[model samples]
Target: METSWEEILEEVSKQIPPKYFTNFIAPLHFVRWEGNQMVVSAPSQIIKSHVEAKYANFLENAAYQIKGDSFRLVLLTDKEESTSHMKDAIENRFQNSEPELNSEYNFETYIVSDCNRLAFTAAKSICEHPGKYNPLYLFGPVGVGKTHLLHAIGNEIKKKDPWKTIRYVDSISFLNEFIFTVRQNNRDSLESFKMRYQSYNVLLFDDIQFLNGGAEKTQEEFFALFNFLYERKRQIVIASDRPSYELPLHDRLKSRFVHGLQADVKEHDLSLRKELLRSYTIQYNIPISEETLEWLAQNCDGDSRALIGIVNDLVLYKKAYQFFLLSDEKIREIANSRLQTNRKRIGFNPDQVIDLVCEKLNVARKDILGKSRKVDFILPRHLCMLLLHEILGLPKAQIGRIFSAQHTTVIHGITKIKEKFSEDKNLFDLYQSIKHQISFQ
Candidate 1:
């Protein structure tokens, strides 16, 4: 007897979380089985790629368990199936063709503020007038919207002129393609690789920092391609986690990167976080109150990704529980739980917290951990206790051990900082600043 798709999905659902199954797996439709291959259709290319990359193994395992044999999984989208032969021919001819731009990451969806204004403006300018910035360099910390801007540039340009050739690729993919081309050991293959990249009217490169770390041949090839694109007056956009000067590439490549406009997106501020949260709540239709949103914006640390993730979790939770309204206390509990989970993932130690407090407050380490009751020492000491308890999620007793004080004293110190956070603006700013530094570190 042949196993049905329903049976396979039922088996897979037991292994996957409910939310994941609903969001990713449920949208898939099993088409048919050919010999040892199981065919599936996804609603969109994004879903198809995500399932192939992430959940295909689970599906394969489930099918094996049900059928008592191993079967390969083949995923396709509706659009691909309509022109399968032609698509395959085109792919074979140009194996390194441009990838699909994420439609969700356009400029309109991107949140702009003082934090990312320069990069956003430069990216928009590139869309309006290609090759103007020549090679726009966008650098910032992780999850700070650099990649979004890269895709936005490509999407906007494509929207304006569908005829323009655009290629959006990361450094790793570029290196991998180059490596594959070289292994062919044919001059024609090498020339094809160069021509493919050079043919693009606009190139949006992401995570260029990955090109560092002894990929000298790749760097040389990239330098040659960079010169090709620049001399041809084609547009190029690059994003990295740090500035061009900080990348360990050849000086020539670094100089080329900086010759054009360079902009950076900083970490999200409180207002930015609130705006992001509001956007996400509206996007997902999560029935969160303004007060809860403010609390989340103030308490949730990290980049926009973190904020969006928490909102997603809330959406899932609301759906699972069938709750129409989330109370303030319940929201606080959820936020605290999320913070605790973040604490485990962040792996910040009490010592690092103490070091940051001392450095930021301009007090010596000994003074923080000592019996000093000076006015300056009090604020730093109190701030350190609050951070350890709130940011690190350290228990009062454990934090007390770090300071050689009783648990009650630790509680009092944290309470003092929380009280001052309401009354003292300077202290509140200092606390927020230190927290920001800790988050980036």
Candidate 2:
């Protein structure tokens, strides 16, 4: 008797956890059998890597139980499909499925600091009583906990009311799905899209600042859905790298975002970073001292993501080296190798940064101070501001005084240069040159 692929997967599910099955295995599609090999498809590369890393053993055991040990298993992402038939099959499989939110992003796991305390409290409050903080606007720099809190809100809401329809989407996914539906041109497909969104009791939209490119159409579509949800008192939460007013949307849309409980997650302070590092150390049961932990927290610039990465790397290094007692030298070596932790210690005054930029870009001190926005002077002026704030750690207000501009203007200049780094090679190279000189100075 021969067994089917579904039967093999069913056996595997019995051995694996339920959450793993639903979040990972359930979305997979068994594509085909190529000679003595079987190929499976996951919706995206992330899913493929996750399934391969965590579920390989269960899959192998299931395959052996169902068929003899002669068969080989292969996994591929939807984009990896070679044939049009496979592409169609994969597309159909991906349709009508919501992107899975990480179960790990619950309130229990989130570490609250003064930096994100208000955002955290507001998230909990909204979950306890939905729609009160309708359109809770969260804004922060990258790798801060904006997205984490967004998912946490969704997870908590679903836990409290299992029957409620909750959806979590980044603006990019929302934009892509809407564009796809519009292109389909089928009335039923468009209606299905409307029904899906309108049915959600809670919608967690992350990185709404990226909600540009197809500004008018997508913005209008989202604005309509937002209005529908808001009118019905369905909870809506949005996270972005900048405030709603800073987003490149119509004033109408921005006004809606501003009407909510707007909160900002600042960069983690030293105490908060120490708390986070200590929490991780305890979780892993690593035998590091308070002194080293404090030193680590003080050395880093309070970026939670970088601090967490260091913790992971330190643990791995400790295990590999089998060090009985970790030393300052060993930790510093690890920091140097893993993080470019050396550049941060070098100090230069804001005046030095301004002087360096002027020399490099062939601009004058008076020109930079004067109210001139010449093509030549603008780059140097922006670079001086950016370098002053980033390198010397000067306050934006202090940097603004150099150019006789408002603090907001200084911020805007830095932001524009940062965004241009991705698209303009000349601008990026100039930034790097200025940065290197400042770092070494």
Candidate 3:
């Protein structure tokens, strides 16, 4: 007797948690078995990729238990189907879309460090108590785990309540949909459009910083949807390049974002980066040495995406070159090729900033870093702290150490400089001059 997909799912459900089976595995369809290969279909490419990476083995095991043999699993998503079939899929997609949560970005796979621990915790809390957090705002620099956490919130919420309607979209997609509906100029389509997002129980919006300028109509629609979700106590998770209050959005929209819990995921420290790299190696079973891992973590400058890429590059290089162990020189070559892109060519650092400030402000290095709070030295000292904190990307504590001042003192100095820049035109000119010299050099 041939085992059906239902039977395989039955075994799979028994093996995994109910929520996991429902959220990540239930929507999958068993297409057919052909030529010793079992075909399964995921709703989207993200889901398919995730299933292939994390759940493929479990699926194989379940299928083997049912059929008494193991077969190769071939997973396909709706987007990857035949062109003719894709037309239908796309048509259905607009009617009622589901969250395109990346399976890999789930709670299990997300690396939790002090850098993102609060965001991670809040995301999990939202999943457990949907709408308890209401509008959870997650903001950070580019390539931080904001998008990952947003998706995790949606995924975990879906798992917690499989019946809940969840939608995850980037700002661009949300704006595109609104523009498409308006272009149609049909009343019914416009109504359908408004109803589309307002119906979701959970909304995850990524890179909301892009929604700052322009897109007036879309912003208005989102404001309405945001209100509807808020009134109904639905969960809303948003990710942006900066804090929600700092975005150039309308004041009304900004108020809504600020009203919610806003968490900032800081840049990954060296220790966090090391753990992230170690997680990647363990996930892929890549045979990288501890020293090499530490070196890569330090050299990668806390960029999670770059760390993952370096690991992938190393794995590929080893497979192609057939090396038992990757030497430091080979790793350096790979890092040079992959990591050098988009980095600063002029090589600006704290030392350079200090030198430029001294030349531009005509202040001796000693006075700038000295304990004396002389009136003349104040501007130069504050200017140096501002540059070190903003341009050099050094922490306030680190900048304080450089100047032999406390971290709070460093913050005060930077804030004072900003206030002075707004009030004093001459000081502002000097500030811009130093910025230009350092930036260009």
Candidate 4:
């Protein structure tokens, strides 16, 4: 099965240039890999037809370029197909566990950056040692490459050993699976499932922090399974949007994660974002000017996903408008269009005009500008002022004037906002939101 994707991909790669490949195809599912031959499968007949009609020549050319003959293509059942393939046949027969996979998520095309070095490194390490970090806890704030890294790792291991035991489950799904197996008088199946993972070379748990403060029984079960695999040196990988220490995990579990490797995914710098945008443009076959790339990097604050979305939108836009290269003015117009199309004032109410003190400290307009400097009220007020002055693009004096305070107060608030960002995910997310909201459409 896995081989199918490779042969076809190789054929497609040779037929179509890298710049145009992404636009021609979506993420693929490898059915098998064997010898010099590969057997890849597509999700649907429609996808198969699209490729056959539009990209068959590219695939054939790619094959010839690679000094190969014809490759096979298997168009599996589409959305209308039965749920049989969705089941984990091996797992069901051996351990009675279902499958958890996202066919669209894989390693062949993940965008890399320093912000995800730790997650990437850990994921790479797991291909070599699956059970070593049993319950390998990957924790970071949201939208910082946790999911992408996790999925890429899963796909890589699967490609290498199609029959190797693998399970990529979101925390909620795992919990539900556990409950299902337990209630059916198949508790034995649950233990067998753990043992199966223990026997497998790899296991990937995405967004594990979602299990924070879950049912005590579930945590206990997970901990036991974790230790079992850790003892055997099997591979385990996990990802969450919070550091282990910050998670509501047991002290023992926290200690275990700390004992292994812990990596923090940072926010992308301007240069990194710019590079990511270029990578996206290249993938989508959308020619973008350097000035436009800089504008996007400086503007989009939600990381690679946000950047890729813009790229995808551009491809769609070009196809619709019959345009070629993206002009700076057009880019800005697209950005504005997206913002207006999907604007959802995340942290603040759009109806309200936050006063300087109120914005700085997250207090009511009346209180921020009021005489009272109560500790509870003061911090929120100062924080709000900082946000408005710094993140929201308001000048210090203007912010202070709104707060009935001096410019010095607004400056202090700005500093505090930076400090808060270091310790608070909510603050960081909001800061990012404000940046994204103000920039691009």
Leading candidate by lDDT: 1
Tens digits of per-residue lDDT, candidate 1, 1-441, equal: 245788999999999899999989999987778899998888999899888888999999999988888999999897766666564555474484457899999998998888899899999988888987789999988988898898889999999999999998999988878887787689998998999899999999999999986999999999999999999889999999988888989898899987789998876656778899999988887767888888787677568888888887788778899998767787778767776776644646788888878877788999889998998898899999888866676655567788999766875787688778878999899889888777666
lDDT of 2: 0.79
Candidate 4 lDDT tens digits, 10-103? 6666656786676545444544434443334456676666766776556545545554566444334344223434445433643454565666
Error of 2 at 396 (Å): 14
Q: What clash count does candidate 3 reach?
A: 0
Residue pairs in collision within model 1: none
Model 1 regions lying over 4 Å from their true place: 1-97, 345-441
CA error at residue 112 for candidate 1, angstroms: 0.9
TM-score of 4: 0.59
Off by over 4 Å in 2: 1-96, 341-354, 357-441
lDDT of 2 by residue, 281-327 (tens): 78776667778877676555536787778877778888898876567
lDDT for model 3 comes to 0.79
RMSD of each: 16.0, 13.6, 16.5, 16.9
- Candidate with top TM-score is 3
